[model samples]
Target: MRAAILQSSTGIDPLLSARNMVEAVERAAGEGADMLFTPEMSNLLDRDKARAAGSIVAEADDVVLAATREAAAKAGLWVHIGSLAVKADRGTAPYANRGFVIDDTGDIRARYDKIHLFDVDLPTGESWRESNSYVPGDRVVAVDTPWGRLGLSVCYDLRFPDLYFALSDAGATMLAIPAAFTVPTGRAHWHVLQRARAIESAAFVIAAAQVGHHADGRDTFGHSLVIDPWGDVLLDMGEETGLGYAEIDPAKIDEARGRIPVLAHRRALGAVEVAR
Candidate 1:
């Protein structure tokens, strides 16, 4: 399967970002890609919640989602908009960082809200309290695609191996871990974590990321990557903001799983007893 990874520099303006994404959809379709993957917060990325509130809306009312769906149908290309800030169905938190899988016909195939909210005070002096604005999702989503059963996840979710385990346990052959990571963390752990996820799951891992400075005055680490099941990097779009394509062979999934056989050997262990 030909996958197009869009490493984007998101802006505070949702409408402008939506237009840019539409153009990218056309480009991906023209390049003959089967699927297009975008970075997290593709619609808007503003650090200031007060200013961003005007742009964030319900999933049905979001112009970015609407535009991307229309573009997907027009181009006859599958699209995965990494995550859009949308109004949550039920929560004290006003919004949800949600990902979408849109089919070639402009139909939404699946929706996955970010479950693991990033609540940390980083050493680099960048503190993120995602739970403040967005509520966590209860469901784990695995969807069917032309390529294979694809698992859906968002930015901070990459750090949780148990999520990947659940996805693979659910019979996912490939994983989409789109992110908008901070620069300090990305420089230190991005590549290693992505490779580890692929190696552990024995599945293809595609991560499209946000890069460089944004309209909101924050910086992001931008190395959008694609890894095969054997932990080999297939495509790594370094720093620059643009589109990167990679070919995913379903056969590789079988080959890696057959060699490692870890998935088969996996056993459910009981809670550990404290040595103390």
Candidate 2:
């Protein structure tokens, strides 16, 4: 299967971003791509809390989601909407950062809310408190697709290896990590963490990323990448807003696992206490 990863800057306007994604979807479909992957917050990226709270709506009401679904149906291909900020229930944290997997018929196959919230104070004087606006999800999600069994995770989830291990154990052959990563952190840890996950799990890693400066005054590290199970970088979109394509060969997964067999070699570790 051929997959297309889109690295683009998303602003606060949902309709505009959706239009851009639709165009990209058409292009990818024309190029014979079976699946299209987008970055997190593909709908909107607003720095102002009040504006974001007021603008973001439920998935059903979101123009971006609706538009993307239509595009997928028209193209007759699968689309992994990396993540969208959607309004939550009345009592929840007002919103949820959610990922959606849409099939060829434009029906939603799976939905996963982001488990980890990015709450940090950066050395560059940039701070984000995602918990203030979005509720964290508890379940780890993986879905079956024509390409392979896919594991789902978002930006901050990339920092946690145990989650990937669990997914790999659950029979995920490929992992999707859609992100809107801050520039500083992305520069420091992005490639290393992604390669580590692929190498350890012997699974294909597809990471679609947000890039460049947005209207909200936030800059992201844009290096959307697709890595094979053997830790080979297939495609990397450097600091640019565009679409990149890569082939997904199931044979590679089998070959990588057969050579390493790391997952089969496991041992239980008893609890250890530290001596003063």
lDDT of each: 0.95, 0.93
- lDDT measured at residue 228 in model 2 versus the true structure, 0 to 100: 99
Runs with alpha carbons beyond 4 Å of true place in candidate 1: none
> For model 2, how does the per-residue alpha-carbon lDDT over 69-152 read when each residue is reduced to its tens digit?
999999998999999999975436889999999998899999999999999999999989999888998889999999889999
TM-score of each: 0.99, 0.97
Pairs that collide, model 2: none
lDDT value, residue 15 of candidate 1: 87
How much does candidate 2 score in TM-score? 0.97
lDDT of 1 by residue, 172-248 (tens): 99999999999999999999999999999999999999999998889999999999999999999999999999999
> Model 1: how far is 90 from its true place, Å?
1.1
Clashes of each: 0, 0
